[model samples]
Target: MASPTLTLHQYQTAASETDRTRTTKPTRFLLLGLFGEAGTLLDEVKKKQRDSGSYVGYEANVVEELGDVLWYLAVIASRMKLALSAIARPPEQSISSYATADNEIRFSDLQQQAHLPFAAPTSNFEITLLRLVAAIGALANAQQQSLPEGDEWGPYLREIFHILIQTANEAGVTLENAANENLTKIFDRWPEERHFPPLFDEASDIAEEKLPRHLEVEIYERTVARGPGIEKLYVLQRCSGILIGDRVTDNIMEPDDYRFHDVFHYSYAAVLGWSPVLRALFRLKRKSTPKIDEGEDGARAILIEEGVSTFIFAYAKQLNFFEGQHEGDLSFTLLKRVREFVSGYEPKHCPLWLWEKAILDGYAAFRFLQRHRKGRLILDLNNRSLSIKAI
Candidate 1:
């Protein structure tokens, strides 16, 4: 007797049925199962290599783990409205066809494949599987000298597919989508194929235009003012962490404001290290840009930075004009005026009170500008103008 071949749709249905008793959080549940099973598979491989100095007799265990990984992958595909067959099949016009005469796959070929709007595996699952294939190829090349010649790539391919499928399921991403998004981003960073450099390096001489733009520009016809609920505003030097200037409503101050200001700066910097995909998904824009941080207590913090040198941190009791468009405009205006004031007035000669007064006057000017119903107020510094176009 021989075992019957299972179709892709049938396998997906079976996998979904097996996990029907679990929680409704399919994404989280599938991810945990995929990684947990993969970890077990890797552990078995490691144990065999450590004890026997090779993975000779553990082939059956590896196959079983790979099957387990595939099962989870099928379930995830079902959740994402994708069929396993769709991911398994190669495109009609394959990317490999465009390879150089020597069969060399250049970065340009990868970019061209990514930009093909009609390409198959446009979803995340398909793209991920392709990456797994690449990994398997690399592994085979490295082990060519040690491994047997006959069917040498078979086990390696299976093992990679198992890992790739499970990992993609866990991340709630399809390989195709991830690859396409990444390729687009890479193209943006390196428009020319010849300009693509090594993946990892410490060289900082890359052209500024080659970098991804994180700066956001907001233009408004009218400017508003921070109302009664406005709390504390602090101007801090980013690199030195010095409190350059501050203004408090009612002349009242909270001791925690200093700590909050410091933590906010560090937190913003930390978030910049996150992947572009995660950053875009979560709407985590760059630091120093105007953004609102809301707390559970109905309070909000309006944060803005001036280039990389200074940051304006403001806290408000409510999410009103203080934490909205007005704050963004005012913060930039105040930062420009304050930076100019500090540059000319010798800190050693000027009293601390005078510096504080300068900041207060800037705040006062921002408030006055908000009162104008119709007019343009332009502040030209160093030939750059922050203009209120119209109201």
Candidate 2:
């Protein structure tokens, strides 16, 4: 006579039952849902601000929307087999402390001048979504996991959950209802596991038809640029360091210097590819032994790699790439953006010009983050923008 109470794990399993009958990829479906739901949440927040001239009147409404975002985040974590506790765990050290003195001073000044509690721009929600997506892409690369087929969504999901949890906590939203209600709604929608028509077929069709034309390398090159403080950019073959494309700020380096830097970048990429953390996270089976090449850089560099290609950014000096006080922390956000670009890249018709454009896009993304000191870069096909969050 009594109704059943669902545990988080049980809720995840029940809600995902319809996943088995669907033809769409799990990650892709989840991504679409995640983005759509996030967009909806952002839309609601924007509407409240525009209609009422402030968000104070719509606090409850915004909290409800945040719950919706959290629902999608929980489902994503469930599909990835990640525990909510793990996702909600904070890093031992925060990344903001890793900033250079100048950066720290600048951030401190911004914090002091901020009026809003979160100090984020009006479009904070949208930018947060972009950052989350970029983080997913980066985690995939660091773990050597590919999109759609990759089973290692745990780390990515954990990161998303962290963001959602932080946002909800800051807003004073209680998530218990949101989680339960979402599962109940999903179970009702799928009910008995009957097949329903695909919801995104037309969207997919349009994307397939237009993606190539819109994402042409030439078009990207024309639109994307190295914003500022970008000394050099290189697109090289993942292991070999054979140059695929490059944009230099100054004259070319000596042949020996170039080779040394190639080797250094390659080594870093290899470590990322073969990292134990990545391996364990994705459950990757080793296919071949990793090869190491000897070589060298004075300037600080960050390497973001895909299956076949790598994008290397060379900065003028050593900037802390990690988030927290730990110097070892890597810039997961930047890595994610690069991976997102690389994964969506069409290689068949790609030329040097296209590679140049892609590299420029990477530069632009890095420059934006560096300038704002707090924000995520979003690249929507040919359109590129920075989502600013107050430090």
Candidate 3:
């Protein structure tokens, strides 16, 4: 069966649902974001030009950037009380001769119609992209001079719609595909409502395979002598008064207190309800099912979890361990890279917000342990929170 038809009207309506900006000047905010995303698209192309063959992932990046541009266009048109389906098809005659302002075209009808004249490529990818950006700039300039809910706005809007289609064609991207991907990413990052996903082991009948919903762990440090004149600082973690993981040292020439990094796994468990490393350490592997045991909670999954913890730690270290930063402050690049790290793993099911919470809260706990040298790391999965208390 064919995938259900998607129209510009439907896409515009869906995109509006994800708008988080509540500024009094929404037009300015939307236009500014439009320009910034366009510039980012250009920058990505610039890198492709500078790096040539080494610049892989250009197509994927273009799809994402173009999808963002489409979102802005849709929202801007809606903001101006214009139907995206109507704006999508520029009038063949002068703007004054076009249908009345109240007249709206059904987007479903647009799906039945053949590709518009603008869909034909007028220039190369670079030239077409430049024209599209220039068209947006022209629209923004026009918006400042006159109120958008008037006849003066129609032509500029139509021109932008025209050039945008051509630009996508020149880049060999399907507009519907772009819109679909945009919705997928938007919902993944910011859903209609926030709710904790069910715990990973919620369905397991075996108690040993289930992660503790409430866990209080003790993390402290001690100095031990390996040689006559040398002593090393080590961090140890325990739970329920029993030693859990082995003691760890920084294992680096510099003392960054990385031995306390287990806080990251704790946070992941608490916030995301998924952490293969912890499952392995706590002997909670779901061994009743071979696939769940060897694949989901297995060695490879554990490695991926450890890799994500270390990767995020390296990123946080450069930004003062994300100190004083709140949600949405972490760079999308960092989060996207992390998503890539666990692309095939079970943890990838968690949303970006959960990952952000895990990282920020984990670093907060890590910083606390670093300062006090010992603390209780608390994991409350029911509450979806992690916190530290100094000992």
Q: Which one wins on lDDT?
A: 3
Highest TM-score: give the candidate number. 3
Residue-by-residue lDDT tens digits, candidate 3, 14-82:
887777664456687899988888888788778888887788788778779888988887777767667
Clashing pairs in 3: none
Worst 10 residues of 2 by lDDT: 292-301
For each candidate, the alpha-carbon lDDT, in order, equals: 0.35, 0.37, 0.78
Per-candidate TM-score against the hidden true structure: 0.25, 0.33, 0.83
TM-score of 2: 0.33
Candidate 1: regions farther than 4 A off:
21-23, 53-57, 91-391
Tell how far residue 120 is off in model 2, in angstroms: 13
Steric collisions counted per model: 11, 5, 0
As for candidate 2, its clashing pairs are 94-324, 95-323, 95-324, 138-336, 260-296
Candidate 1 structure quality by residue, lDDT tens digits, 1-391: 0112334444445555555425657344664565566566556545664776454435444444445566665565555444454434334422221111221222222222332232212235334544554554454354545644223433443355444644444333333443333333223222323221221111324433121223211111222246777543332222123222222222236532222222222222222211222123234423222321122001111212221112233422222323333311333334334344334221222222222333333333333334532223333222212233343
Ranking of models by lDDT: 3, 2, 1
Runs in model 2 lying further than 4 Å from the true structure = 1-7, 18-26, 53-68, 74-85, 93-152, 192-391
